[model samples]
Target: MSEPPKERVKYIDTNLNLPYHYYAGDYKALYLRALKDKKILGSRCSKSGKVFVPPVIASPETLAPCDELVELPHRGIVTTFCVVNVPVYGREIEIPYVVASVALDGADVSLYSLIQECAAADVHMGIRVEAVWKPDGERQGDHTDIRYFRPTGEPDAPFESFIHRL
Candidate 1:
C-alpha cells in the first residue's frame, strides 16, 4: 500500500512577562485588608459623598484625593451582566460564566467581577450577590483575592435603591 501524505502540526510562540516596578498605593493595601477579612472596601469622596470600589485614588467627579475608606457590606445587587462563553488567554476560569457589575451596599459605584457557582442562564440583572472570599492564606492582595461572587439567597432590591449608585 502507498503511504498517505503526513500532516504537520504547527505552533506559535509569543513571549510575555510580568511588568517591572508594578506599584500599588495605600488604597491597594486597604483593598487587600478587606479581602483578607471577607469584606469589601470603597473610598468615599468627602466633598461629593461618592464612593468607589477598587477604591480610586481620586474622585472621578471632583478630582480630589479620596480620604474616607468605607467598608461595604458583603451583599450586593447586580446592575448589569454578560454571559462569557469564550475564554481568553491567561484567564484561569471555566467558560459560560457571567461577568457582572455589582453595586455593594453603602457604595456609590458598582464593581465588575465574575458571578460564579451558578448556570449562565440563572444570571440576570438585579440578582442579589455576595462575596465568596478566599481563605486567609490564599489571599494575594489583589482583586482575585475574593475568588468570585456567588448568588446570595436574598431577594433583589428595587431598581430605585441602586440606580443612583450606577
Candidate 2:
C-alpha cells in the first residue's frame, strides 16, 4: 500500500518587545544655546594653553578641571580624510562622502567630521575648508549644527598654515 502523503513544513515569525529605562541630561541644552548664537565653543586649559571642542569638563592631559570657555572660528583646514561608502546602522547617507579631520583656526587639536558639498575624489590632505552653518531654525547643539565643511574658494593653504596643529 502507498504511504500517506507527507505533511508540509511550516515556519513561524515572532516579534518581541522589551522594556527598559533611559535618562537624558542637560548638556545638549547648553550646547544648543551656544550653536544658536553661531559660536564654536571649546574648553580651555588655562595652564597648558590647550582647547577642546564640545568643551570637555576636564583636561585630558593634565586631568585638571576646565573652567574657561573659548569661542573658535568656524573656518578650519582638512588635515586628513577617508571616503565613506557603507551606510551606518542601515541608514543611507550620501555615498562616497569624505570624513575629514579638521583643525579649526586657532585650535591646537583637530576634530573629525564629514566634509560635504564637494566631490570625494577631490578631497585631500591640507585642503582649506570652511564651515557651512545650518539655517537658524535648524540649529542644534550637535555637530550637525555646523553642517559640514567644504573646500574654501581661497587658494590651497600652505603647509605652514596647518602643520603646527598637527
For TM-score, the strongest prediction is 1
Model 1, span 18-60: residue lDDT tens: 7798668878887876677676788888778888987888897
TM-score of 1: 0.80
Model 2 error, position 4 (Å): 30
22-100 in candidate 2: lDDT tens per residue? 5423433555578878987777876687887767767888888767878889888888789988877864677868889
Which 10-residue span in candidate 1 carries the lowest summed lDDT? 1-10
Estimate TM-scores for all models.
0.80, 0.75
Q: What is the lDDT of residue 135 in candidate 2?
A: 93
How high a TM-score does candidate 2 get?
Answer: 0.75
Candidate 2 residue pairs in clash (backbone atoms < 3 Å) = none
Give the runs in model 1 whose Cα sits over 4 Å from its true position: 1-19
State residue 92's C-alpha deviation in candidate 1, in Å: 3.5
Candidate 2 Cα outliers beyond 4 Å, as residue runs: 1-29, 158-166
Whole-model lDDT per candidate:
0.83, 0.78
Which pairs in model 1 have colliding backbones? none
